[model samples]
Target: MTTMTPCQSLTIRVYYEDTDFSGLVYHASYLRFMERARTEMLRSLGLDQRALLEGAAGAPIFFVVRAMDVDFRRPATMDDLLTVETEVLAVGGASLSLEQRVSREAEPLVSAKVRIVCVEAGRARRFPPEVRAKFERLLPDQA
Candidate 1:
């Protein structure tokens, strides 16, 4: 059976602050949207970044972006409602890869492949079982 991976979507409205003088969203704005979507995805799985990093009764764990490959296919203007879709592409002992896309009414505007690494005390660390389980549940089926 082919399992459907968990995907999360967040809607963001383009504001003047997110755009350039031309009223088009700056390229960096898409990156911010994608980052928010990823954070929300983790929250949906019961992970709180602030608490995790603050060591609130648990070992301090931090998620850091290791690499990003982004493509800007189109520009969004102020007031445009953009949807950021995030999906888990892969998970490793100490890293996770995600695919995120920004779309406007079903039309893709930007796409990115992001790699994140798990760190504790400035060193890479394997994901704890609880955290790994959450990600595993969202793992895409291998073709």
Candidate 2:
């Protein structure tokens, strides 16, 4: 099993718009929260996704979700303060494996393993060396 790096947490408040008629957060809302957390994680590392996508960082590249395994452990209601925690599980030549968890205080509400790939010119491409190095810094230290 791969050990995950320390998490980058983003706090999100569940809004009415994020909920279904029953007042429970819509299933898809969790995906949006996790996506924001991942974006913030990259931003915290000084990687500007917009710049990368615009080719200002060498070549235009877009990070796209390749796969995801998600588990809904509990339900979240509108106005609930949730934390979306994202951690880098593994970095590869052209892809990244991430673990994200949504929790209300200390209780986990959802969890997912997401795989994302770098694409350029509509084809999968290796991550730029600098970009890969930035993500590598978040990997667990090999002792």
Best-fitting candidate, scored by lDDT: 2
Per-model TM-score, in order, reads: 0.91, 0.94
List where candidate 2 sits over 4 angstroms from the true fold.
1-5
> Model 2: per-residue lDDT, tens digit, 1-143?
23334678899999999999999999999999999999988888788888999996688998999999999999999999999998888999999999999999889999999999999999999999989988888876621
In angstroms, give how far residue 45 of model 2 lies from its true place: 0.8
Q: Which ten residues in a row have the lowest lDDT in candidate 2?
A: 1-10
TM-score: model 1 vs. ground truth: 0.91
List RMSD in Å for every model shown: 3.6, 4.0
- lDDT at 130, model 1: 84
Please list the C-alpha lDDT of all candidates, in the order they appear. 0.88, 0.91
The residue-by-residue lDDT of candidate 1 on 1-143, one tens digit each, is 22334777899999999999888999988988998998888888788889889874268999999999999999999999999988898999999999999999999999999999999999999988888888888876632
